[model samples]
Target: MEQLKKLDKIKVAIADDLDFFRKVLVDIFEEEEEFIVSGVYKNGQELIKNIFAIKPDIILTDFKMPDGDGLYVIEKINEMKYNIPVILISSYAKQDNEGILECLEKGAVDIIEKPTEQSFKASFDLLKTSLLKKIRYIYNNCVVLNQVKTVESKTTDYIAIGASTGGTKAIETIMRDVKRLSKTTIFISQHMPARYTTAFAQRLNSICSNGITEAINGEKIKSGHCYIAPGNFNLIFAGDHIELTDASKQIVSPGIDIMFQSFVSEAEKTCGILLTGMGSDGATGLKKLHDHGAITVVQDERSSVVYGMPKSAIEIFIVDYILPLNLIAGFINSISQ
Candidate 1:
């Protein structure tokens, strides 16, 4: 344990209503030297009250709590303009749950299941491993948004974008800049749960001039419009129309690689843009697209919320341009024009 303490430690804050669960979390982290429990709260209200003072790198919060819920904590953190990321913990996470979806839309980064079936030791072991992995990923790869360059005019036949983790904000930034685009059909596959995709599509449509909508089966691809892959389904193109499939049939929900691969045969004039995300979902598909003559763009490390996806694509040596978040839109515009 002493030798383990020599490694870098990740600061963690935990909030749960049940005393037993709270104590369980504290004990679990105590055994792991790589994690230091900055604070543990019995409720969301307590966590919010002491959050700034604790200044934890990330928060692990229960979905439902007696005095204010996880959503309340997230809202409070936003109100205070804190950069901390929150992970919602629940017994079960249904993709259709409005509260879960709302928490995600409101800015909670990810969700995990609270172990309830196993013995204390078993549960602690599993939770600690999963929790530590997420903490390390968020700590190491979280990107800060820098000022973006002004976009220049450009036009393309189709644009396909894949993102996860910090995707919502990154997509918003890109769409805001590219709203002036004409004659381009944009397809977005963001790693999100089911009901939240509709909310996200509506949110994006409201902010940007682009006609953004959640994708439905058998819908024809249209120019100057943006289609978002529904959370429970994988968005793929069949000839000239969009198709939604049960994501369980694929590797990842709204799989970026699946969508990118589907575009390979039909992509005559295409550009594949892989944005900030947590995994290497789009690397293989992006490589296929790049080999097929599509202009491939990736978000640079400085602007990526998590560099995993972009880093994987870069490692494969398939990327055409590696640009910062701010410059991606302008670069795309310049190339497409």
Candidate 2:
């Protein structure tokens, strides 16, 4: 892994309505040398009003607040085109899978289970550790938004996308922007927890023209649809059908490498795309795809949330194109047409 970039303390702005919880977080951050509490707001409305002026490197906001909520802050930040990463600290993360998916879909980098009134005292240590770890992880993997490039057309029967970390937004962008895909089937290998995949697939299905669903074992593959590997399990291409594998032993569940490698036999009809992610799981498999006559694309560093997966594939000199997020969908469409 690449070393963390040398920089000053990571500036964090926090939004929460509760005084005690806010102070607890402030105190915790104050004790850590890595973070500096740049601003504190009682609600998302206040945060939005001063966020640009404060220019925090990260936003840690509560899901529920008096004037505005975490969703409000996320929508505002995105509307303003700021690149700052947002993490939703929410009690709802434990029970509301759909709500958590909404945050992820709206562009939040990650979500943490906030301590409730009952769990606060006992969960303090765990919460503190989680906060620090998530902050550092986001700081290290943040991406600089980039412009898109046009693609030359080619025919493809299958499209495989691999992503992790900030992949929810990345995948959403492609699915939302890509023109109707009637000629090819799409497959996605996203690193996510087991509980969220169904909701994620449903979220994608709502916005994408192509139907989306969690891949099922023994299901026959077909065009005009998109299938996402179920979280914690591997989805493999088995000629005319799909196969689900136990991914407990793999380093990352729904391992991108396993999915990409499984398509070698169909390489001539496949387009392998490696998007923003935190690890190198898809690199070797993408190389195999490239060598086996598949079209290979990697999200460029400027457009990647982590750049780790794409960088690994690029390093192996296997990719045919390095694209920004904006162009990927159009490029896929170009090939499909």
Question: What lDDT would each prediction earn against the true structure?
Answer: 0.78, 0.83
How well is each residue in 1-337 modelled by candidate 2, as lDDT tens digits? 1222335787889999989889999999999998899899999999999976877878999987779998899889767655567889987777878877887776787788888778889999999998898787666655322211122334889999999988999999999866677778899999998899999999999988888999999999877789999988999999889999999777798999899999999998998999999979899999999889898888877667899999999898746776657556766766773
User: Estimated TM-score per prediction?
Assistant: 0.54, 0.56
Q: Which 10 residues in a row give candidate 2 its minimum summed lDDT?
A: 143-152
lDDT by residue (9-41, candidate 1, tens digit) is 767899998788888878877987778899988
Compute the lDDT of residue 336 as modeled in candidate 1. Answer: 47
Q: What lDDT does candidate 2 reach at residue 95?
A: 81
CA error at residue 186 for candidate 1, angstroms: 0.3
Off by over 4 Å in 2: 1-151
In the predicted model 1, the residue pairs found to clash are 148-326
What clash count goes with each model? 1, 0
Instruction: Report the C-alpha displacement of residue 227, candidate 1, in angstroms.
Output: 0.3
Clashing pairs in 2: none
**Candidate 1 ranges with C-alpha deviation above 4 Å:** 1-155, 249-251, 335-337
